[model samples]
Target: MLPLIPYALALPLLWATGPTAPDSLIIFNASRTYHYQAIFISPAGDTLSRERITMQPSGQPWVGQPKRQTACTIQYRYNPGDSLTFAARPNPQNQPGRQPQAYEWRKSTVTGVIENPQEIWMHPIRSNQYAYTEVAPFPQVRPADLHPGGSWQANRLFIMGGWGAFKGSVRPFYQVKAPATRRYGNQNLAGCWLIESVGQHSRLGNSYLDFYFHPRYGFTEMHYRFYDGTQISLVLEGLPTGNK
Candidate 1:
């Protein structure tokens, strides 16, 4: 996957330079008119990647349907200040009378960073409201594993709360719990969600997501910063509602 570039950095890069196609290239199966590109540096120097991403066209509604996409990693040596373009293929989904443009078509720049970028959700509250006490499981795992939580079984009530906000309001937040027995990798003990609340009049400002981590049991730590400068948190008092 291509690294995500903020709106701030993207405009400048697009203005300066676009990717140069390399001799060695691989094209994936995609819908007609699909157009995407990427640039990276390896031992041999720099290589550019391009693909035509496909999507199932409109028309069928009764049976099951699936969209076309691709997932693969581009191997490249790491370097700071190096920039790469992660642009998507053109709009094959766009035809006469159909939407004239493809919203999914995107372009992003990936730049190496020393410290990982910071993330904070604008909205803190969840919409599916539930307050109940239930016996939570425990797991055994190592500390870092315990940090992301996976492998073991511990006892605590897994309480959760969520809601949605306006479009482009904030990013999503997610986390998993650590098990009692310190074991291996971060596992089922973790999860994530993006909440968006939409309606007229009682509009909630858009764009907010919160980050959290679990260790031990009961309540996982909440990590989100609000625009109001106020922060809020809660423990897993009980299993909150709305789960599949």
Candidate 2:
């Protein structure tokens, strides 16, 4: 017991010395139960903080049967006139394996510029369906289009394509269902775009993209549903940025 005392005393100090982000914020939110291992990150791409929160589930009214937890992170440069963007391509881990004879899926890019704390230009490169030619066929606009006047008015959610031989043949697809404007009110910018029409073969294939914006941390809630009944839901509540 005597040697254990020293180890216990050092435990608190070890956690205190853990790495943290430079100047970012993190929020942890739960829907069912508290999770001690929850982690939050910042837009500067750093771990801001971690916390545990108690949660209550809506459907099942058991003592502790269905417990759930979520985390959120924000990263942004604060230096005056500073700018940055986040980008990621679907890797083998998130996409189906390509056959030698099959046409490979090109990497899609989405760019967002930090403009104050109120607005951002989240632009994406548009392309043709069959030929893969860029939509804007001119030298100035063919490669990319930077829509600067836009703002990050809603949550951002992405669905990952799973790896399997049958995955490619299952008809990759995705959809976005907007809520009734009169009931929910049109508040989010991303939600305003209804996905009524989508190509047969799409990255969002058979996936549901859903998210809601929070005040402090921008967008927090995210839900992605796959065709085979698998779903991933995440929520970041109590973000320092207050909601509308």
- What lDDT does the true structure give each of the candidates? 0.21, 0.24
What is the C-alpha RMSD, rounded to one decimal, of candidate 2? 20.9
RMSD for each model, in Å, please?
Answer: 22.4, 20.9
The 10 consecutive residues of candidate 2 with the worst lDDT sum are: 134-143
Candidate 1 accuracy as lDDT: 0.21
lDDT of 2 by residue, 129-215 (tens): 111111101011100212222212121221123222212222212233342211122233232222221112233244333444322
lDDT of 1 by residue, 72-106 (tens): 22122223222223123222123335434423322
